[model samples]
Target: MAVIDLSKLPFPDNDLEKFLDSVCETHELDFAAYAGMNPVTQTVHGFVNYPQEWQTHYVNQNYVNRDPTLLLAKRSIAPVDWQRLRQEPSFDMVFSDAHDFGISDQGLTIPVRGPFGDIGLFSVTRKCSAHDWALLKAKILGDLQQAAVHLHDHVIQSEALSSVLGPPALSAREIEILQWTAAGKSQQDTADILSISHRTIEVHLRSAREKLGALTTAQAIGRAISRGLIYPA
Candidate 1:
């Protein structure tokens, strides 16, 4: 495994670009990025070192809705290797276009979750033989996950979530419930895990939604993640 010095990370919370640059240089990666979105509002934000042409192509093509990485990211909490993603045949053009712009199929995406329903995907990509890619991924996967978490946390602390709602204020129980639910646990499943009754769980979730200014439990989860109040388990 590569030796990572966490103390040397960028300080004052605004040097995220420097941090990503350092990682790409140190790891000899082709591209590295940290991207976040507010699921409730579908607002997207990204810190990326990808080729500008690729970015423009993605935007102009309106690929966000069709991007397979995003589709998996929305539902997944675990880190995803690009090779393992299941994409529809129609999305082949997206990958083909990316490759044409020098973006590789060999990549990894780490999903980041926050309290008010803010989700982030930190990704690193490189072009290499399959064997080399696997070896590199195995060696750096842990470090990448750590970096993603740190980057997400820094972004959350530095940025203002919304102009009107501000940061959400959720209770401990509410956060706990939301976290479990974000992990795909049903209300009954969460209630059983927490040793609480189903009705009680529902009550807390309802209150959480109101506190977060969300209209439903799912929206509440999204809002909570956006506020960094509850991370997906």
Candidate 2:
């Protein structure tokens, strides 16, 4: 389905819930969710259709810190298959508790990176034979990747910070400078190419990083590309 359909929904929360429901029905899965954590505030937001009891228990127990799936989200940008995660003794409790709560042992999590240093995970869970799930994941992986991107975009737009403080927009020159940097140009090189002084290049690059809320030039470049604010040369 086109992600634009989400915009037609009456409310952001309603849109996400309906999307999760559609995913469950379309894939014959037991549950679906889109979850994210704020990097600075350490707050979690969930658009999930799981049992309220399970959700409550998870938070009450601070399961997010120990959840193997969410822990993997920190280091991976690819889709994760629950079966493929390392089966360590320490992580066993997470999976065991999930199964007891009716969450399937077989699931997929698509890690999504947003421009503003936020990460989102789009997950689908189902109880199925290992063979059946492998085939299902093969079929839906590509579609879910695209869906994850759109879902994260919608979430970012609906965030309270976006409605209030908003993300800073880089100027054209700032974007151009970062694009050149991403293309492997040094500050001096980009300055020469753009007929500007090295100090001016440094200023623009710093401004771009600050605007993007990035700690480094490389991070600023990455943020710009992720947000479609700039393209690689």
Candidate 3:
């Protein structure tokens, strides 16, 4: 199976079309789309590599609210295969029009949960037989999941989105402690370096974890780095 090193991809800015195009080409997919919901604002932002005509038609018809793929994927922890949604009426309603644009219903949608309450859905489609689609999905599913997380992080960290949803607030002491921890220093070492009591370090670390919505100090460091709040040691 092919492994995609999504970390090497450029971080997305306002335009995600190029990023989606690269994902499709790398994964041998026909089309790629991303939809992310900001829990704070309850607004959905999307990007797609589909034809412009279809894009316009989807919006004109107000399909965003009724698309089964998006609805089902949003509620699923695992990737939602188009096969599973084929029996739904909304599936036909959306894909019947999609077919007119030379698109196929052979697709998969992966959902990524952010540390915050945000959610991102990454969908890819291909025109292929059921057997071929199954094999393709099996081979690329892991990479697609990685891509989903990468895309979600970059999207939520984008300047446009950050402007609306402010980045996690970490105080100076909290950041200092996290930096030391990321540098492989023990809590005692960090306390000694800062000339503070070990209990103070613990308090700051706990606060940092809560602010980043991280379950552990290590996860907090990773989330901090991904959000450009701290650098990797």
Q: Against the true structure, what is every candidate's RMSD?
A: 12.0, 10.8, 9.3
Per-residue lDDT of model 3, residues 1-233, tens digit only? 12122334465433457768888999889999888887777777777888989988988788888898888888999999988998999999999999999999889899888767888889999998889898998999987886777677667776365646664579999989998898999999999999999999998998787667564788889988998777888
What is the alpha-carbon lDDT of model 1 when measured against the actual structure?
A: 0.74
For candidate 1, the per-residue lDDT at 8 reads: 42
- Relative to the unseen true structure, what is the Cα RMSD of model 1? 12.0
Candidates, ranked, lDDT: 3, 2, 1
- CA lDDT scores, all candidates in order: 0.74, 0.75, 0.82
Off by over 4 Å in 1: 1-13, 162-233
Error of 1 at 226 (Å): 26
Residue pairs clashing, model 3: none
TM-score of 1: 0.61
For residues 196-220, what per-residue lDDT tens digits would candidate 1 score against the true structure? 9999998898778766645468887
TM-score of 3: 0.66
Which residue window of length 10 is worst by lDDT in model 3? Answer: 1-10
Q: What is the TM-score of each candidate against the true structure?
A: 0.61, 0.63, 0.66
Greater-lDDT candidate between 1 and 2: 2
Clashes in candidate 3: how many? Answer: 0
Worst 10 residues of 2 by lDDT: 1-10
